[model samples]
Target chain A: MAGDAGSIPELDQKKYDADEQVKIICLGDSAVGKSKLMERFLMDEYRPQQLSTYALTLYKHTATVGNKTVAVDFWDTAGQERFQSMHPSYYHKAHACIMVFDVQRKITYKNLANWYKELREYRPEVPCCVVANKIDADLKVTQRSFNFGKKQGLPFYFVSAADGTNVVKMFREMIKRAVDYKQNPGDFMDEVMQELENFDLEKKEDNSEADEDGLKAESPDLV
Target chain B: MSFEAKRCGVQFSPPSIVLIYEHKETKTIRKRIIPVRNFSKYSDYSMAAERLKNHPRHRDYLEGVSQSQLEKLHIILRDHMQGFSLERSLASFNLDPDEDLNKLDDEELARKKGQMDELFEKNRRHKDDPDFVYDLEMDFSKTTQEKCSWDEESDDGF
Candidate 1:
């Protein structure tokens, strides 16, 4: 419902035909409300005391953009570090990611850098969004230097998971970006397994080539 | 009958054979166990044993199966307290413990960076809106499964 465009009353079945599928992963520390955020965005419901995702939970939604429909695959990853080992499986298929943090807890915001650092080790250039959750509480304003907007160099949305504000707009933008990426042949995936297999090897070659290219290349292989 | 598992500082009790397997690289072997209830004893034992034998990593570790080993295994399965021990699963890749994982050309790394950029952009646009708020809405009524038939085939959070 978050990505829904209008309230015309009549359902447009034709728009659903041009759907492009995208996978978005919600990742962060335990008890950060990744699942709840997702539920709020997709279903517009809230559960205060829900169990953290033990493995991975998949949620599907279809958003109509103009004449095309976008199918979103939201993969919720478990927050614990022990469970972090399973991240590769989920990230392996992810097209984009939403790293969530709790605004009330400074430590949660501090860990955003680490999450970014870890995610940089793998994936291609996929769009990311940061969420500062739990705005319903009074702001202590201490140690608030962790700017959600400036540090990540990405889109950021502050929302109250409890009160339901700005959550829909945030997800709508995500779906739009996902849909844009999907329209490009280079991004939408079908034989991703094969591509992943050769990806590391390709990076190794590119890295060595970058050294020889001597920064003249438009984008140096970061690896 | 009792089945219990103790490892990594936590204990779990399942009503069937407790197969405690460890993985090292391609090799995987059942190293320890605490069997509590064995409704289908032979099938459970055979399945566990077969998993060990067929595991890609631990095939060499099986070696010869002596009569004494079989007796020990049976005793461990029959008795509630007696069980086996196994080493923790080890990764084959010799990665430095302190080495930053960002050096790896894994796909997750790239996606995260992009996600960060997107978050920054979103925040810049809506950081000060007074009406900004989070939403929590779900259709929990859609779930219709009233009965659960737990199956051994279901992976244990693999």
Candidate 2:
């Protein structure tokens, strides 16, 4: 091994140059404190402002994880319908997803299934973590709210964006999980579950029927 | 000897179940044979049964299902549950049909184009410049000014 002492420096340089880039997407309904959680985790400061992200906002941060430097890109997405059309592209190539829901709002908790459905449709292999944000407002969320995650076999975290409680812990664990997933690709059971949920054995008759109905109804020249 | 062994040489060969239902839109009846193993990775027999009951095509068929037919379905599904391995099942599924239909209309396209142009204009000033210190400070000042103006405009909109 000492025969290649001169190559040690080159190896160190190559390792430094090959830092892993992990893309993590934050998804949830509007006003669920997704942006606040991201800002609190990245900047260690949270300010209440009229923050309405119209499109995908990218936040870049570098961290050292177990002797390896990782570049983490957090994509904060707008939950409004105006930006919904661009979601597929935003979710494309994402390594991990963080689905946030407000603990105080039952509607946000119920909507997690829809968000998860869309996430699986786009990136089935990627791991997802559900975040129950604004826990400071309500320390107790219904156990039923978490049954969805349990059924789907997803990791869940409860945090408060306002007071910065468990925000750092959740993000660090997510980063480590993402890095481990990237280094050691393993079998994903959740992908199988998602596939089964989306399976439809019906024939493709809806498309042809819709096409014929549209053509007959819209063509004035035929009349 | 087991029933399967007495009938055939196989140890546990369960009969495959076939379901016939009429398509609501096309008014055509179709028959589908259920897979003996791996009914679904996520759903159990009860969930699949619920889905079948709620399915528009199978609604009529399920409405008139006799007690014997229901018992037969349950028995087949219970047998199928034995082969439901998460690791062995195929994980591929079709993407949402509506996802492709999310095309932006002309008005939305024009707005997006305007936003892109604004972004390009904001970035065009600092392109092709190697002066690190000067570019960094200038970009910082320009970004602050742009944020101030954006905040004012957004306040007005609100």
DockQ, per model, reads: 0.04, 0.01
> RMSD (Cα, Å) of candidate 1?
20.2
Per-model TM-score versus the true fold: 0.43, 0.44
Q: Against the true structure, whose lDDT is highest?
A: 2
Question: In candidate 1, what are the lDDT values of residues A112-211, reduced to their tens digit?
Answer: 6556545543444456777777655532321133344243356766665555667787788787876665455354333233333433324323331221
Which lDDT tens digits does candidate 2 get at residues A89-185? Answer: 4554566889887665555566666677666545555678988776565443422234446656787676766556677777887888777766653
The superposed Cα distance between candidate 2 and the true structure at residue B114, in angstroms, equals 28
In candidate 2, which residue pairs get closer than 3 Å at backbone N, Cα or C atoms, i.e. clash? none
Index of the highest-TM-score prediction:
2
lDDT on C-alpha atoms for all candidate structures: 0.46, 0.50
Residue A36, candidate 2: Cα error in Å is 0.6
RMSD of each: 20.2, 28.9
List model 1's recovered fraction of native interface contacts, to 2 decimals: 0.08
